[model samples]
Target: MAHYRASESKREQFRRYLEKAGVMDGLTNVLVALYEATEKPNDALDFIKQHLGPGADSTDAEGSRVELSELQHKYDLLLEENKELKNRLLQYEPAADHRGVE
Candidate 1:
């Protein structure tokens, strides 16, 4: 129980420190936007740059990400189907008779 209270006290102190630094609100807003993103970014650094840098996209980023994912799924399905068809074709090739064809 003592350890738990100590942990909670430390958390409050850290929260107060963040609030005093004036960075808590900015961080919270940035994190909320990241949460609302359709395609979650893997790299936090790159994600921050895309939002705060001059090269940020004026177009819809989530829409583009969704379209790209759809295309990738289609590509994977087509590739698997192609592999199956190739295996089926190989099975249909007439086997050469060893009596004279050899």
Candidate 2:
């Protein structure tokens, strides 16, 4: 049918576009790597993201995650320290009711 042919043409064109852009090859390589892994990753999507996303290194991604967590913990500690310092400083300040207009 004419409609079937048109659909097939569009599909073929899209396929060629993917090939031209190397998307097919890149995806194929990623899939092959996944297939060849000795032990399957617990989270396949995360594995795909690590291999296919920017920087494309699982160790780098993991290191970044660890660094982020450490920095977050440091930030929390700093916040608590800041709050304590502010409270200590307030102890020496005059009460609000003591202020008078000059």
Candidate 3:
């Protein structure tokens, strides 16, 4: 009887912690979405792994290479965008300053 009460108290504390942390809602949503999408009973484990695993961060060389190449391409694209925005800002600054002087 004493052990049962202690276990119940621990369970209640865990439930309250999950509710306070907003984890219940997020976890419920993820599990529900996966359940709705699943066609077979075994798909739940696969879907969970696909959604929550390291994704592309595998230890294999090909996976590492692919991730590295993708990140490099994104970095290059952002750098070009930054350069274009700076050029446009320079073009606008002179006009704004000229108007302020008048």
Clashes of each: 0, 0, 0
Stretches > 4 Å off in candidate 2? 1-5, 20-23, 34-57
Q: lDDT per residue, candidate 1, 7-70, as tens digits? A: 9999999999989986687667777899899998889888877665554555667678889999
Model 3 CA lDDT for position 89: 95
User: What's the lDDT of the predicted structure labeled candidate 2?
Assistant: 0.92
Residue 15 C-alpha lDDT in model 3: 100
Query: How do the predictions measure up, each by TM-score?
Result: 0.38, 0.56, 0.42
- The TM-score between candidate 2 and the true structure equals 0.56
RMSD to truth, every model = 12.1, 4.9, 11.3
Candidate 1 yields a Cα-based lDDT of 0.82
lDDT-better candidate, 2 vs 3 = 2
lDDT of 1 at 87: 89
- Name the weakest run of 10 consecutive residues (lDDT summed) in model 2: 49-58
Q: For residues 1-102, could you state the per-residue lDDT of candidate 3 as single tens digits?
A: 999999999999999999999878767776886768746456677766665455623556577788999999999999999999999999778765466643
Candidate number with the higher TM-score (2 or 3): 2
**Predicted candidate 2 versus true structure: per-residue lDDT over 6-82, tens digit per residue:** 99999999999999999899899898999999999999888788778997876888999999999999999999999
Ranking by lDDT: 2, 1, 3
